[model samples]
Target: MAGKRSGSPDPKRHLWVLGLIAPMSALLPSQLVLYTKLEVFWWIGPIIVLIVIPVLDWVVGEDGTNPRDEDYELLSKDRYYRWCTYMFLPVQLSGLIIAAYMWSGDALSVVDKLGLAATLGFVSGIGINAAHELGHRVEHLERWLSKIALAQSAYGHFFVEHNKGHHARVATPEDPASARMGESLWEFLPRSVIGGFRSAIHIERERLKRKGHRWFSVHNHILQAWAMTAVLFGALLAIYGLRILPYLVLQAVIGAALLETVNYVEHYGLLRRRRPNGGWARCSPRDSWNSDRLVTNIFLFHLQRHSDHHANPGRRYQTLRTSEEAPQLPAGYATMIVLALFPPLWRIIMDPRLLEHYAGDVSQANIQPRKRERILAAYEYRAAA
Candidate 1:
């Protein structure tokens, strides 16, 4: 069923190397601070993610070009693409280790240390994106690497919850990661974190039960994943002393918050309709909100091609296509992340978009249960009008 790519060879084949920017951005600040003796450079990681990338996205604009269907096989098989992500692990670990050293030392003031922690948090958050790409792969090494990447944020459960839980129930009321119509980022974050954690445990426990494995057995994937985090954090604490604990915790919280913020953006208010048999409809390209801005595509490894991803969950990052049916985001994830922090601003921008996506049907969206009456009152009139 694959069609040949009629155009010249993939234009972006070599450009995939630029994916290194996310991991390298963390280390760039350290080198700048080293040479210039300015602590301000410690803030570069967040600045690059929050400011520079969004600016680049605006300037460079969206790239709707998809790798031709015929090329998906060749492109996904390329070892070079695999290495681009594999190389991220070293740079990411290096950034965290370097941050631990700096956080433990007395040379930097509290403000400077906090800035560095924020930088590392963004790095860790972006590392989660790397883990996401890797975690979805069927390869054992890549799956293990996914857990290692998640170790930085102490969010090892995501490896299970995402591939198992989210991809199953996305765009539905049952999915905690799927933000409802009226849910703000603040309200959604805690629900997602706690709910996802519980879901991961439940998933793992069910798997273990089927295999006749005890709850405490080595076969527990969640325990195996969390063990890596324990060893990673323990090693850092052992080397850096206790002074770095607060910053360690701070960066982890920031990293987790960043990941959850992106989750809130991915499927905000989208819903899968129930079928005649009371089953949910299959997730289609239209279920996930997608963006294809070139910069964020490279940075997040085509994660914004999300609708295709949910549709073809096994597809590699480089080969994920933009879908015509997917509801498009006004801006890339970086810009949207900042907007999501403010509830009113988020509703002002996304509420109408959500309504519009469902053809002005307020009943079609996955709305927050507590706010459903108010949301209907607010938007149903507009829908009818």
Candidate 2:
């Protein structure tokens, strides 16, 4: 497929979108409170969002732009995304505060309270999400915001690894973060989490060696991240006491799970074939997922524009555009994540398409497969290799 042509970004549109961040962040705690109180309503948020949003988008349909313009330049060094990053600090902090309150109140049931805390924790993932965008930038303020965002999630090394490692080597077997074709979500999660962290350590170590410093020193982001996580956990313990420790851990786990779920969806079944020279093709927007669903796009700060992100890592979230040349998920990211929870269904739905796409390229002789068995065999060989 041909790549989509996008128009230059519009700053006004970016500001309009950035305006929504505060309200969304503010509303999340209240929504969690309601969910905790009602108990039954917890499922409602995911249901309504996962099901209804896509149906509505399908009915309304997207503008038929080959590569939909995201207007990334609008926020690309502009103050709008910076302002959003600044605004996000309070929003995430409020979530931590609310978790503390719930832990202290002792009025709510364990499940309900944990649910609320988990929701907030998931919201905290937005910190990493935002950082994922800003860390790619060259500016000092943006880089700082990126670190702050990652620090908030207790996943600070991602700021270094994602830009230095993942982007540089995505869609290749060498990249621990990339999901291989036909790999189940269950299989990918542990590998990605463990491998991603190790990659970060490796990247930081290389940087330290280059600078003639010890890898374990304060300058290393991995050690810094551990210290930051310790401080966060200490604060949680202080505010909520021992009773809330498990809940906080669970909340972080759930948030991490949510992040992994997103990773699964973003690059599920995508692959970069090896060239004759033993190098994978250069990463393209086509190697990642793409969605134009406006609602979740707004909530994710346009992260659904995965192709644009891979193509231009330094671009602010406000500007990530949609590209037609990129492979698209059949539905919005939220819905796709829900589907990914079912491994059989996910494989059945995705494997055939991937096989077809990979095999269709005649120029890529190594990717050719005469039949489905051949495709499966090829993957199995690669996995073992």
* Tens-digit lDDT track of model 2 for 1-385: 1123223344234434543342244246446546576564333334344565556656755432322244333335568556766677666666566666666676777766666655555565655676676677787776766776665457777877788888888866677777766577898899889988899888999999999899768788677766777787788777668877776676566656777778878876676656799778777887887877665665667778888788777667666667768777777777787778898898678766655655654223222123334554555633223
| Candidate 1 Cα lDDT to native | 0.90
- Model 1 vs truth, CA RMSD: 2.7
TM-score of each: 0.95, 0.82
lDDT of 1 at 236: 98
Residue 229 of model 2: what lDDT? 71
**lDDT (C-alpha) at residue 308 in model 1:** 93
User: For candidate 1, what is the TM-score?
Assistant: 0.95
Q: Write the per-residue lDDT of candidate 1 for residues 1-385, one digit (tens) a residue.
A: 2324433345676777887877776677768888999878888878888899999999999999988776777788878889989999999999889889988999888998899899989989989999999999989999999999999899999999999999999999999999999999999999999999999999989989999999899988788888998999999999999999999998888999999999999999999978999999999999999998989988888999999999999998888899889999999999999899889999999999988999998889998988888888886443333
lDDT, model 2, position 204: 91
- Model 2 steric clash total: 2
Q: After superposition, how far is residue 312 of candidate 1 from its true place, in Å?
A: 0.7
lDDT of 2 at 83: 71
